[model samples]
Target: MKSRWLVNLALLLVVAGIVAFLYLKPQEHEETDAVHEVSNLKLADFDRVSIEFPAKAPVVFEKKDGFWYLVQPYAARADQVTVQRIVSIVAAQSHEKLPADDPARFGLDNPRLKIKLNNEEFVFGLYNPVTSEQYVAYKDAVYLLSGLYSETASTQLLEMLDKNPLKPGEEIAGFDFSRLEQWQEVRLQLDKGEDGKWQVSVQNAKPSQDDINEWFDGYWTKIRALSVEPYTPDRRAGYPTFSLKLKDGKQVHFEKLQESPQLILGRPDEGMRYTFPADIGFTMLNPPVGLGK
Candidate 1:
């Protein structure tokens, strides 16, 4: 009888161990599933997106270049800071639930801005679904409000000024002198005329020496503060180009393709070759003229 009891006890212990193992296995699986769900969330995947503004234009950003460019009307560079701000705002709120009805309150009226997802594009219009209010789209979201046009004018003006300068000689080509105070004081000399020719003379052209310098300094300070850090190209795109905006709101644009980058400035065409400083901004205006044809 005692031997029979021992066998029965061993069987009960084995059954209890199996039941415990089965119960703990599911809890481990549940914990693993929770971690996996959180890991799958990502925001950078939507980094490259497009935004459109009504009565204005459309802008596209490519992840490879990490720069924003205007898409519609014409292909042009977009404001870097503006693109960054929009991306940041959108990515932060990706997981939030969007509200229905008066979505314009969130800046969705007019539905001007469109965002491109992996395989889909979302459009947000500017308009008051119930009332007649203007709307603006930013990032991947929208907002309903007025005063959109006021900001648009200033924004477009800055974009135009950035691309073209107001230098005296060039017609379509120009530099915006809105920022001119950042450069250190450099000497300027003009040669005296010999009978019908000119001569060279150096004058005290310090920042304190002329009112023009003071005005220019102030203008440059403002521009530098607002302007984005200039981008450096990996390789030489073409001949080196130089643009200088004078204190008088005049611009001088020059280009030379010789082995060295040189620029000639001033009227009667003074031969001045500026060795571009790394800090000073540089940009390419056109393709190479004569080399390796």
Candidate 2:
């Protein structure tokens, strides 16, 4: 009976060993096998990107002075986050890769979209029904990548536009609110003093340095618009205009387009309209006065 019990124990140990080995071996194999990335190109190295879709003009972006700018479909500042998403295709990885010898089988013969990062071009084709991955042809090979790459490339031009009212890295030195009805009499301007501190033009209203800085840096400097679109030229003229003077001696002018439901500010020079929530919009024009006391 003891011999029989020992034999049963040995069989159980052997079964446990087999289960452990079977579970760990596949993990070891997966670790050794490196998945292939779609392209060898690095994001920082490629400064130019051009995305072309079927029956639509190609949109292009160029990096200048460490900032991305939309170079096609009318020039404007490109949203950094959106551009990064489109450019990230270069680093995309794929489990399956095949030769580009037969392009039609994967729909590469007539690609749905083409994205060029500098000189390296990636052609997007049909989606794989089984895996639901997109077929992309780059260089001599075709790769299966997530459909997100194609979706980001297909984003509308306006959606890609930067929503910030001011240019990236621009510092506001002062605001000229002389044209605004409420501030016209006071000639309200928030300008930097000779000591490099912020001061308001209103004589009766005295706000602390911290109060001014909070409004400038915490609010105006970091404010982002809800949406941005091309400005319409036919909009009613003589709208209240305000200008922000930057530290570099450049002024960005904004015309108040709407007030009640939402506040819309139009930059005629850039031909862009910036929409903002009405509550926050009023504070932009009206600074903190006597609040510091």
Candidate 3:
């Protein structure tokens, strides 16, 4: 009887040990299942989204032609980067504790911008709790809110280049009068040397070979960095317009004929006309218009 009782006690201890081991082990298999479930979500599930901005307007985007396009106020160009960012935000898993009574608090309100998917639109409205004043919408959604402004800046500068009349070896005749601080201190003269090389000189100073090359390269750099912003049209009256003196020795004086900033090349008789989007250009040292502060 003593040996049998000892054996029964040993069996009970073994069963208890097995139960504790099973309970203490990590749930590795369960975690693997959870990860697989999240990874299985399909991108095609979200076909449409809508974005509405505060106080301004709402935009709807549809995936057509294998790309997204804005359908409201005429089919305008859509920024692809903007679309991708919105889609990613919408598709991301929400883990934050949602408000019990109001989900709209976390919804689109006082948003910097809004985007719309296929059937549903994500609205963004700004809520200034401190100021009590909210600006709901951006004026030009495509141009103002989207990242395409950089591209627009480049295009505008290129357009302005089209109106300029400067050439490789063409001279622009103008005397630098220090007394009249209305124009640039140095006058530019372009000439071709006997060696068939382009030369740019300022006044009587003969530019070194390195100086000429540097100046030429600098001009191109300035052209690339050009940008335009909104300016007051009325400020044209304060600007001093330059009078072009052509190589042919004819003077063409320009008054602020149009409020728009433009690159006036050559003498009025023989020159090219280039107009920038705004008054900001290399020639104008002080930008005339305030670019939205």
Candidate 4:
């Protein structure tokens, strides 16, 4: 009888373990066939963009040779980060559907912001006061997407310009300067000694290594343009006073323009000129007088 009772207890424990296993199992998320994507098109497939805001003319951006360029208002370089952010947010999913009994009531008639990715266009409308979601009209469907989409797509033309002038392709090794300070001509060369110490030389004299390093680092790695202007073909006059040579054998030439300009730097190869303060030239081109002075 005791042996029979022990067998019955073992069976009860096995059943309890089975029940506990079922209870502790993780259930899969429900899958649905319905798609509520804000943008049916992929961002990679879009080669051009046209953005319009209420009471403002549309600003168009075109991608050429894998680089984004502004094609409207003024032809210039486009900020890739700003453009991609808008495309990524719109490409996301939105499941919330809001009532659209009156188009005018939800700002659908004239969307506050409109974005056309390639051939397809989307309109951004009012924000729901209670839920704080935004209304968007795309492909004959009005969606109540997160308000974050509206905020991202709203961008200004000037804000989308690339602040950095040249798409310099290589790490800078060193640079050459002629008539840098109106009287001084310098040719800087950076090389590592057998001991792996960096040394910079100007002509036959070795100037301050710290000053040369600081100039090169700031000019190449950290310089930002004040503005970029469209290029017009004309006599360039002469070679650049300041020339930056990359490690990859590509040389970037710059020519200063006009008198007393806050910004000046022109690149004829890309056909788009960039500008920085006139004082920057003075700061960068002024070399150290003598080492250990």
Number of the predicted model whose TM-score against the real structure is largest:
2
- The candidate 2 region of ten consecutive residues with least summed lDDT is 25-34
- Give stretches of model 3 more than 4 Å off: 1-52, 56-113, 116-120, 124-186, 189-198, 201-203, 212-228, 234-238, 241-293
Report, for every candidate in turn, its global Cα lDDT versus the true structure.
Answer: 0.38, 0.88, 0.39, 0.69
TM-score per candidate: 0.32, 0.84, 0.30, 0.67
For 38-149, candidate 2 gives per-residue lDDT tens digits of: 8778889889999988888999999999889998988999999999999999899999889999999999988999999999999999899999999999999999999998
- In model 2, the clashing pairs are none
- The parts of candidate 1 lying over 4 Å away from their true place are 1-47, 52-58, 61-67, 92-113, 117-120, 125-216, 224-293
Q: Write the per-residue lDDT of candidate 4 for residues 1-293, one digit (tens) a residue.
A: 99999999999999999999999999888987465776656778878888888887778888888878889877778888888877775577767655556778789897788888887877788888987888888776788777766576565566678877657244555555554444344454454344534565544565665765666567756767777656764564763455666667777776656425564667776566676677775555554535444
Error of 3 at 5 (Å): 42
Candidate 2 local accuracy as lDDT? 0.88
Candidates by TM-score, descending order: 2, 4, 1, 3
TM accuracy, model 4: 0.67
List candidate 4 stretches off by more than 4 Å. 1-36, 54-56, 99-102, 146-154, 168-171, 182-201, 207-211, 226-240, 257-263, 268-282, 287-292
RMSD to truth, every model: 18.0, 4.2, 15.2, 7.6
lDDT of 1 by residue, 1-293 (tens): 99999999999999999999998776644443121111232446554655555665554554445545544444444555555544443233222233445655554444445545334444455445575544434334333333333233225423422232222233321232222222112222222122422221223322222333343334322322122112233235453444554444455644432322332111113222223222332222211111122
Where does model 2 exceed 4 Å of error?
1-33, 194-196, 232-236, 291-293
How many clashes (backbone N, Cα, C below 3 Å) per candidate? 30, 0, 25, 0
Q: Sort the predicted structures by lDDT, highest score first.
A: 2, 4, 3, 1
